[model samples]
Target: MIFRPIVPQELNAVLAQVRPDPSTAVSADTVRARLADGEYRHRWIWVAEPCPGRAPLAVAIWWGSPADAHPSNLDALFARSDPMWAFADLRRRTSSAPRPTTDPRSAVAAALLVAAHRVFAVDGLVPAPDYHLLLPSGWRDRPETAASVAWRRRAAEGAGLRLTAEQLRFERAADRPVPSLSNRLSFTPEPDDEIFVDLFRRCLSKSLDTTSTRKALRIGAEEHARDEIAFYRHGTRGRRSWWRIARTTAGQVVGFAIPSHNSVVPVVGYLGVLPEFRGRGFAAEILAEATRVLAAETRGGVIRAETNLSNHPVVAALELVGYRDRTRRLVFSAT
Candidate 1:
């Protein structure tokens, strides 16, 4: 087998061989653009050659952070390829200087861990003691495996890590009673400016409980705000773009939902209700309204969202509206 860096010319070939469908957002062109823009630093696109007469296989996409530059990111593009084998390949490429373990257990899991370690290594990155893998609802009820759990823990400990178990909660849409409210909240799409900023600040202030969680969520929200604004300002190439849905009541801005057509999935960039509007089910209402709009725009697809696991209210609100729990993203530090 041979491992080599992919060049711009080979991107289309890589996508053709690896990508599930030509319409996926993580295409060769998209990755190349990110690499060109310096977002994807210390990255390697690897293909595995078969022995003798077999066709070459696109094994994995390993991305690393420039700061740490650990060969960690490995996504098995070919279904026939074993993830563990790809992980071992990455391990061989990494320098043995007490480097953090790159996640190869699952697609992109080890990659993200390595990336975080690279960025926050100097700041003493702490792993979650034991990582929690959220299973789709009902996967836990029929479980019977100390051996399985032990194996997971052994893998982590062997890699100088630990593992734990926890239930991940998610919202799924179901026919439910909608609360009655007189606010008459409506969504109006517009550019994210001072008004949206203020709305975000207000919502975060009310929603986040702990000071640390608040601060972290605030930073994330701010960054997302900027990205949404940029996407709206300079529409993404080869994509449908939109910035609509502002929630207001009694001539006062309460909340808003920013939907864009940049990816294969229509993303809800930002959605929130001011502190003053809490308990009135405004958050759920706005999300439901956004879902309606998205359904109208697209035939049907999964709506992706991420929130700190600690935020119970937002999680509950999402459930109230009709989003399902997909996966729990475990973020770690290498330092």
Candidate 2:
């Protein structure tokens, strides 16, 4: 088997072999766009084949750069072994760059590290110690796999990687009726000017330590404040909806949740309650209201969210609102 550069004509053939689910597969147009985008690096399309007269059996696609290269990692790992040798033969022609010496243990590790680095770099950071390989549903159970748990453990340990435990442990409490805070706080779908300003302020306060915001501006929380407001208002730009809910009696902006159908799953992109409103069940009430709205619209899909794992209160609120722990990702500092 030989790895070689892929061309536009081979897109469907490779897609057929890789068999990615419809939701995740990039369309032909998207593929062409990425190819045209000068920013993307190390994009590769490869095919694995057996001895002479044997057709190719598998296809691999990888992308990203050398300041954070990963497709190289996969090639290095696969090059070391037998049928895997054929896997290495399939490579896409990419601009030349110096390669890392460390051997990656699995294609999954290569793919994950590439993705992790991209996310971190986009936020102007590097991969963190707590980073773990996020395996999609069926990868773990495959047979004929050279990638083993022991190999993964060794590779991660060598690279100083730390992983979160697979199980999501939570303290269970007796079932009690959700407190009737909905009546105490009226749920308004639309936010007037004053309410929008208050919501923006609350989001700015909550996101002071966010990976993206912290990297870009040291003291520009106010700027980010406006950006958040604009993000909901004009940035969404006729594509998604935004709303704010405030406590009527105090007239304080208790909490805000943005439920958008922008991805494969409906996402509650932002949610927060002011510091003074903390511990008053206001966050839960806001989430419950959002969930009610989503349910009414028959939004029966996973809702994804991420926060600093150290933020126990926010994690607790998510659990209370029916979000199961999915995976923990580490955000590393970019030097």
**To one decimal, what is the Cα RMSD in angstroms of model 2 from the true structure?**
9.1
**Best-performing candidate as measured by lDDT:** 1
| Model 2 CA deviation exceeding 4 Å by range | 1-7, 13-182, 191-198, 206-209, 212-219, 223-242, 301-304, 327-335
Residue lDDT tens for model 1, 158-183: 43443232334443332333343334
Estimate, for each residue in 107-196, the C-alpha lDDT of model 2 and write its tens digit: 323333343334444665433323233333344455422243334444333333433333222221113223344576766666464565
Q: Which pairs of residues have clashing backbones in candidate 2?
A: 2-89, 2-90, 3-89, 3-90, 3-91, 4-91, 5-92, 125-334, 126-332, 126-333
TM-score of each: 0.52, 0.52
